[model samples]
Target chain A: MNLKNIFKKDNIMPVAVLGIICLVVAVLVAGINLITRDVIKAEEDRKISESLSIVMEGGEFEKAELPSDAPSTVTAVYREKNGKGNVVTLTKQGYKAPISITVGIDAEGKITGAVITSQAESHGKTGIDSYVSGFIGSDAAGVESHFSANHVTGATVTSEKIKEAIYDAFVVLGLAAAKDTPDVPEFTPAGEASLTESEAIAIAKELMDGSYTKVALPENMPETTHALYKRQEGGYAIHLATQRIKWSPTENEAIVTVDGLGNITGIKMIQWNVGYDKELLSAAPVCTEEYLNSFIGKNASSLNRVEIVTNATLTNNFFGEALKGALDVLYPVPIYSIIAIVIIALAIAAPVAVVIINKVRRKKNEAK
Target chain B: MKQNNKLSIFLRGLIAENPVLVLVLGTCPTLAQTGSVIAALSMGIAATIVLACSNVVISALRKVIPDTVRIPCYIVVIAGFVTAVQLLMHAYLPDLYAMMGVYLALIVVNCIILGRAEMFARKNNMLDSLLDGLGMGVGFLLALLAMATIREVLGAGTFAGIAIPFLVGEGYSYTIPILTQAPGGFLVFGILIAIVNKIGPKKGEKKRKEFSCEGCPSAHLCGKVSCAENTELVITSEPEVQGTPEGKEGEA
Candidate 1:
């Protein structure tokens, strides 16, 4: 029989039923897939955006395309204010995502105001929370390269990732931001503890006369030096000489800007990784700002008779360990400790998931 | 059997009739799908879909085909409807498509669809053949559901994957260690068939109903043989002839 014969008035009912079923199933499958597509895209965007924000400039952030020939990991540009309250824009990376930390730089290149124009990171937090904040009063503005800061600790991996992002952003913007080929901090000196009272005084004297240049560099470093100078109070000072960035012994941390003659002109302590957020210091639930401030006026001298925080005892111990290493050159114990902890935690999670899966399988089988 | 004999035609196909349990014809697909109630359900429905359509088409086109080539012609018609059922399952109920897997495509070989088409559809009255195909299709589906219920419970520890609330939490598990395997599928299939066989039609009673009907030849004289057994319902053996005794002597 011909194909059209199948569609006769006598054969209509069954064919109509089949056609309806097919139409419903086709529409349902297509509709469900279409809805999930946008949901999946949004989820992806949220996750990636969170990571990128960590390295963005402070305040408001914007996403912009990097130039075609940009170098490194730079992907976007950002603008923001600096410490002096003026608009100082620079792109850099720390332990987190790539971000442009814009601060106001004056004629002398001192930071006036600071802001983060853009980043890919969690809101209000990045690897720089404890790293770049160390540069409040410092201006490495005109300086092409060279910088260092104490490890932001607990956020080490994130900090390193941030540094890479900053470099990428710098390349995209085609501008010079702080350049350090891997500015890993020597928080705890290799072998010895930091300087003692008498030792601190002696190192201070050496630094004042610029005798710290005698210390051997970490092999391939570029022109590293240290110095001490007399403050107005007649007490000695400690200074670091890796470009314009400075680390002082008298204050928790101090920045000294010298023009050509190497005479100290502008000096300020932005914030101490171990000290308060500012001159007044922010109080913490575990460690009081007052307790942390006690160490601000004192150096490696009289390092005895201190107590850990009441609630945050371990944090206190860690804080002391960080300080002991930074000023005294204590042993580098934190790195080994962190690596061991991470491995153990991951090992625990893996076995737990496997055991759950295996148990579910075994129980199901046993039932039958 | 006379080509015109409707009762012998419908009964021989329907009772001798049964597609699955008696002839054991569609056993491959029967055993495969009887593991779950839903698979059995959809398979039964899909088969019924093909059977009913094929029978109707064959019945409609019965006179158009040459007798020498009729079996082949009927098989082609049956296969076409089976293809339609397969495509319908794949596009609409994809989950059921996965559940039935290869078995759904194997509806072409279900024998019940083709057997009825050849035995009933090719020889009988269009209306009678269509009814027989429907009755048999319904019977096969009912049998599949019955077998599926038992297999899904004892073997898979599931009553169609909806946890049997009273047996809840105890046997409810993501993995079915034994039933998930092949040997288990076979063992469960056999045990379920045994249960359905036990609780199902008594073999002796089945042999009795098996031959009782011969409604069409002399429906009035063949009183008890007429399917509407309770009444002295004088149905014509030949529906075209009214009050059959008037026409009886001419042939006699």
Candidate 2:
């Protein structure tokens, strides 16, 4: 090829233009990166410092080198300069997603305090602050053991995950002995009912008075072992079923009583293997009477206001689903449900309307 | 070349060539970020900064940039400005940076930036290009604000996260949750386009050809045979052909 052809307008011009633009852009980007890099680092450092202070109160924090082979969950460790405590940032898998916590553990092998740095769980409903505060006075030696004894009702998964993370931190510090717990079992389809259908019907009849006729549960109701029933007095009864623990194979059922106005009047734990086991049953009140009473006045829309029982998060969530199922049957005209219908209708109709309009326009054009 | 008046350069983007409503450019980010007023504002500002900077740079280098490689050159310049903006936002307004997410980086590919660069910036003076970019940016911002206001107020029952009294709450009754989702974005965008089309200036005969490649912002860069250019070529060549008796006889 001729040297003149190599520098010709078509061949070299495109390459030169692109090369020059790329060079200019690269230089500009590099200059910006240099200017902002320190500021970005400082912003991150400020955030960490803020979290450290919140977790370990009344202390100045200096970044401490994390020990090699630190648990994967442990992101950073900070030593309290003026105090005998260290703030460890740990990320553990919560119910919905990873929950990041900054935990302060004093030299005495006791939790000073803990603050949730980041969490995917809904803020208000998780009660994570209260759960973390519970660990303030607890010994770190067996923090995982205390989870079962003091598990927060509505925030069970988040609470347990936080406990496990703190436990790992303690084990890292040589304050606690590490013990492995089996991973919780995934939810399975409902199996054979522990309570006979006749027995459930009899219980439902007694709760509301009058002959109860068995009815099919509404679509998309929570897991149920027994068919729902309606009383002659215009109230409904349904079996709200859930597992005793996340890992448990056996199913537990609660008889939810809903009045004509869609309010949950009562809840009774009718069938649970844990209820039958005297030793395990004595550990904690799984669903206290007061806790069940808290749901009494709440309807489907106001179910969010129902306070979760301590140590009964999974059970209450299951109960909440059951209450929702009852309300779905009672007050089927939810605001979201109506919106859903409208959207679906529009989705189906808009395309059809367009096609019809086009046909009409085409016919008019043909006539003209 | 006739120097375009600065006011026309600015005013044209607001009405005649409104980036989102009229031109129908950069619809993706416009719809996605319009779910909230703050998000839309942040997106609009970020996009505007990038647009203005890219336009000025492209206009300044217009003579130097070879015609064949202009698009890639424009892209690289736009991408640089976008990355710079991203870094600054990340450093100073970390929250808004996090909220804008991928959409901020996506400004590199936004057609409005490249479209303006190819059509207006490459031909116009630097000052005019800068004004054009600012005008288009403000037009996009106004469009986003309009869509976001309706969507946020109706869907979320909030304005910039502040709860709108009477429109929200249990006793007051009525909030459409769907308005915050993707479909609501389209609905609001379509309505705004229709309203803007009705109230804004009617398209002149010249602008009626906008749908064709002749009026396309990227038509010159696309390297396609534009009808307007072809017609002009024929008209200009026709007189020369008529001067020759043989060519006139062939045309007749």
Candidate 3:
């Protein structure tokens, strides 16, 4: 039969042939990917480990795992020979995305080293990149004793997040210390702290039930910035994000009062910026509506609070900044959006623009 | 007209139908995970496997799959592949797996995998679908590589983390200041899209396109999660079925 005649049948042979060919082709491709991945994974892991060793006190860095119930997301825990039990590298939410870092500490619960193992945060300034190495050889508590890290010189929020992440590491290790798990077992970094949104909510609920979840710095609250959205009967059902919120709840109306940790972590009812006022704030610059909103329903437990941004106006601004900061930290935003949009726009415009530019040139030639 | 060759499969990813740059199919991982070239490449490959494997299985079982549950079946197959990759990566390539974060799991929802299943694999036999899947995987890889190349060099002052001498570090030559921030990605994406669009066929000048997909998005906002199952496909399928001899058979 002629090759042309083969097309006339529209037979299963074509499909069958195609099927067999495709099966072979697909198996081959997938096989290649699997094999290639092995090399790629080895190469990448070696590189990252090499980078980690440079920042951390150099050692074999044995992998450590947290108890299933203990909260944290770190996958591998490395211990120093001195029983310092430091350099727990894992992931954590930073200014943009989950930032992977290796935190180094001494036996006394102080940060000696901090390094970004891998980061999806803002490009250059997780602070883990810039000043994290400075932490090396210093005590893990150096952040508390030494100068506080300001927002990144260029990338403030990102820098602050890294600093806070270091602090979070300290808390994890410190709590481990206090628990008489004095051997200082491995503590989870954020990557291993895979708490989903609902889990976050659940964590908040637990803190309220007299759980000592908040093992971080926090001070007692004296005054609170309050905002009551609606006038109600038998007292207003006050809205509070969390127990960390310092202000007392009295009926429907609530106050934006609380500086650090606990109930007031995120937004609650009428968030600080939107339905509330910027001018009116607590005497000590009680956390703004945004801050209050953050901890709207968080567990009221132990967490040392400090005056991060004092002054009434400044406090509200801090709240606004904090909420925006929180959202910005949570999402990578325009970076990803921009690339996607630009590539698409350029792709579509290429064909049209080419034709238009060509037509214009043609018209000019005709006129000539 | 392109031949099904190794070079073709590789090159196709670089330009013709990039999952990120060209097709704009899997935007979530591209946007959320690619802070560096390493992250992007790892995600691309992981996703590529899921795409390729799922395509093959779906093709193999096409006859057995009842049309009534096609979508669900496709999802189960794709998700199974994704979960397998996830476990494998977690066990062996723990670092890359960890770096990918929630995005690693989010691969199931990635439109690219589903789009390939619905658009190509479901309809075609094993070979063409295999070719198409490979082409798509490469395309996605290229798009991710391109994005990472830009983001790393400009946004972070490094290329694959080598820290180029004059281009970025100490006595750096150039940089988009905003790109170091989150919003910069959007600004860069928009500008590049405009430039790329300008390079293509001019607006309204012989609209019959060459390589563009029939339901491709507007070039400017191509990856904005706009696709929601093209309604026109559903509408037009019935009419198109009436035109051919196959239509009579289908009708019968």
Candidate 4:
């Protein structure tokens, strides 16, 4: 091939066009990158500051250089301005994804507080609320055993992973016992108490007045199931019951308070087992105090008529049924009796109407 | 070529040639980012900015681009816009950038941007191409929002992370978790496409005779037998056709 022909009009046109376009695009991208570099860095710095404040109880943070031999889990260390503690950010392998926790360890090596900055653990909320809370007043040496003894039963993996992060913080502060020591023990709590029967009774007592007294099932109310507590005071009875929502595997236990006039005074969720599925659990609205308070002032018969929470429809519906069941035992509306009477009336009216129609038809036929 | 009206040029991409639902382009990002309403919305805006910017630049340089190297030229321009958008999002909306993950960078290869460049921007004026890109971008955003709404509402029971009061509560357990997963993404995408197909313009209305070489942008440079034969026939017949004036006059 001739070198001159290679650079001729036919070939060079395409090559030059592509080269110019590439050059222009590269210049444009480079210009944008230069402008955004500092801003991006600042944003990351702000996130670190926020996480530090949350875990360290709101104090100014100055970045501290990590020792060269620091463990890989210790991503960054920040010293508190008041000299109270050091906030250590650590990343540990969770059950599904990496769990990042910012832990504040005081100068004396006691954990001040710990907050999960970012985590991919499936049941993180329950773990954070229950197991991670156990670390607040514990020393660095006691973290492993405390976690092993009080791990959130259903969220064992997540609890253990959080413990690993806390242990990594211990290593950073030079408070750990030994490098090769196991972080989490194999002990698991047998039959963890999510909610106990006595706890449900206590919640009912709080919702009702102090004068309420627990009573055995009355002769007229034998059909009520899951009724943990039945209290009667001033001609009113408050019943606390647990009812499973239809189509849901979990059950919601609630206390329903009723007045003498068959009106629901209050309702409260004592305990609930929303499923272990992460997406479903996060999406399922917790039966909060404000939500249960909305059921007050409505008659038991009108429980289904209340406004349903948008995403918590099934939970709200379950609360309604539980309240309705409790009210049925007290008021005995006799919905079945009303239905039977209506059917009997319809059965008698149908034959009489048919006879009158036949007599009119005979008269018309005779005239014709 | 007859110039399209400004409104029709902008509106056509919204329904007639929708990049996501109608044309079935850019399914990777559509499925991945649509697990949440916020993620889907962020991806849509980011992609739209890139698409519109790339279309305008490509159309402006259309005259300078040689046909043989058009695809590479278009890709470079598209990738530049994508990188710029990614950097800007990272700097300003860092949370959204983190949430979108790989899909934001993946916009460079998203077929909608390049497809518009090749099929419309390369042949059209800068203004028309800009409008086409905007319309297609908006169409893509709408399709994503529709899917995200269904998935987030049914699967996660939240609209943009704000819980819907009716769908959630202690005793309410009717959420279908599968809608937020990958299979749900495909199901919602297919349903949206079907709905668009039923309501939008009828298919096959403009019938063009498609030859095999139609898909090759540089058909003149192709060394295939069919291309060579066609070119040779045209070259050999031209002089004879010009010399035979009596043959043309017989019809007159």
Q: Which candidate number would show the highest DockQ if scored against the true structure?
A: 4
DockQ of 4: 0.24
Better of 1 and 3 by lDDT: 3
What are the Cα lDDT values of the candidates?
Answer: 0.50, 0.74, 0.54, 0.71
Over 4 Å off, model 1: A1-368, B1-16, B168-181, B188-252
Candidate 2, pairs of clashing residues: A153-A313
Stretches of candidate 2 exceeding 4 Å from the true structure = A1-4, A53-65, A71-73, A79-368, B1-4, B168-174, B201-252
What's every prediction's RMSD, in angstroms? 29.5, 20.0, 21.1, 27.4
Q: In candidate 1, what are the lDDT values of residues B82-152, reduced to their tens digit? A: 65565555445545654665566677777787788787788876777777777788778876777677667
Error of 2 at A181 (Å): 17
Ranking by DockQ: 4, 2, 3, 1
Summarize candidate 3's per-residue lDDT along B1-252 as a digit string, tens digits. 445464575456555555665455677677655567888898889888888888878887787666666777777777667766876775567667656766777788899888988887888778767777777887777767776778778877787778777676555457665664556656555555555456733432335433333355443244321221221111123333333344334433
Model 4 lDDT per residue over A1-368, tens place: 23344356976799988888788789878999999999977886677678787777768888899987677889999889999989898888776667667888888889888876554343323345556667886786688676353465456777777787788888877788444423442111222334455665576666676445556665655232344344555334444344332344554555666666666676666556554432554544446666666777666566663434554545454556555655677677645456678999999999987866765676567658
Native interface contact recovery, all models: 0.00, 0.57, 0.00, 0.63
Docking category of candidate 4: acceptable
Report the lDDT tens digits of candidate 3 across residue range A1-368.
23234234343454554455446545764665676676655755775677556645555576666645332545445667657556666666775667766777767666666767655443333334666666555554555444544534555565655655665565555433222233432211111222333444343343232212222111322112221121111111112221122122111212222222222332333323212323444333344444444444432231223234443333243334333322232232524456678999999999988866766676567668
Measured by lDDT, the strongest candidate is: 2
User: lDDT: which is higher, 2 or 3?
Assistant: 2
User: TM-scores of the models, in the given order?
Assistant: 0.32, 0.49, 0.46, 0.51
| DockQ of the two-chain complex in candidate 3 | 0.02
